[model samples]
Target: MQKRYRIKREKEFQEVFAAGHSKANRNFVVYQIKKPGQTHYRVGISVGKKVGHTAVCRNQIKRYIRQSLLELSDQLPGDVDFLVIARANAKNLDMKETKTNLIHVLKLSQLLLEAQAE
Candidate 1:
């Protein structure tokens, strides 16, 4: 993901946590807040020590999430900020599983647009 499309500051994450609406499934928690006048959506990802024992594991999880978000970017709302926090159950998932779990959570949060049949 690009830096412009990511929420990278502690203050930004805290603001989202404080004011955003949240939804979750077994593997992920999604916090969403609308940002007026924003041209595109931004995302913040968090995979903590509890979810992964080492930095490599955590980074892998993050990579999976970033890839999923990239694939879904066109379907996401342009004026929203999303924060995705991974649960411990996410540690063992492969890329496909991660994307599936993320889609479930995003649907719950109403962040994902339905895919159009062409």
Candidate 2:
């Protein structure tokens, strides 16, 4: 995924969490907030302590999320930011599963518009 779209700050994460509409599915929890003016979305990856404690584990999960977002980057709506908050289930999933699950939730949340739907 584009580096510009990654949510990093503690405050920004908090804001996305606060600003977004949330939903929980079998695979993940999605937090979505609309950004009307942004030409592209900013996605934040959060793998909290409950998921794993090691950096490698967290990075692996995030890498899976990022790679999925990168593949679907061209498909995203122009005016939305997505925050993918990882659950315990996300910790062990392989990249393909991770990507599919994330995309599924994103579509369910209506972040991926019809123009972008695959």
Candidate 3:
């Protein structure tokens, strides 16, 4: 994902956590809030030490999660700030499974912009 589409500041993350709504599954907790007058979606991904003690492991998890979101970015709605937080169980998932799980959760939360079958 591009830097423009990422949530980089501590205050932004805190705002999303405090005001956004959330949804969770076995692997991820997703928080989102609609930002009025914005034109794009901003994302944040978190893979903490609880999920993986080693830095490499945590970074790998973050990479895969961001990759998954990148693939699904076109389908997501704009003007939203969203965060995906990894759970301990997320360590067991590979890139493909991580993408699948993340997509499923996004769909469940109705965050993705549904494509019309024309």
Candidate 4:
């Protein structure tokens, strides 16, 4: 994902955590907050140590999340910020499963557009 599309600062993450609405499934937690006037959505991803033992593992999880977001970008709301937190079960998932699980969580949060639900 591009830098402009990522939530990079601690304060931004906290703001989303404090104010955003959240939804979760077995593998992911999704938090979304509307940012009116913004032209595109931004996302923050977190995969804790409990989910992955090492930096490489954690990064792999992040990569999966980023890739999924890239593919779904056009289907997501342009004026929202999303924070995705990975759970322990996520570590074992491959790319397809990661995307599936992420999509499920996003749908639960109503972050994905209606026409994109398929």
Per-model TM-score versus the true fold: 0.96, 0.88, 0.94, 0.96
Cα-based lDDT for every prediction: 0.93, 0.81, 0.90, 0.93
Question: 3-46, model 1: which lDDT tens digit per residue?
Answer: 99999999999999999999998999999999999999999999
Better candidate by TM-score, 1 or 2: 1
- Clash count of each predicted structure: 0, 0, 0, 0
Candidate 4 clashes: the total is: 0
> Cα miss at 88, model 1 (Å)?
0.2
Model 4 lDDT tens row, 9-82 = 99999999999999999999999899999999999999999999999999999999999899999889999998
Residues 71-118 of candidate 2 have per-residue lDDT tens digits of 887778778766888898888799888987887888788776643444
Compute the lDDT for candidate 4: 0.93
In model 1, the worst 10-residue window by lDDT is 109-118
User: What would the per-residue lDDT of candidate 3 be over residues 1-118, giving only the tens digit for each residue?
Assistant: 7899999999999999999999999999999999988899999988889999999999999999989888887888888999999999999999988988887788777898874222
Where is model 2 more than 4 Å wrong at Cα?
115-118
Candidate 1: residue 117 lDDT (0-100): 33
**Model 3 whole-model lDDT (C-alpha atoms):** 0.90
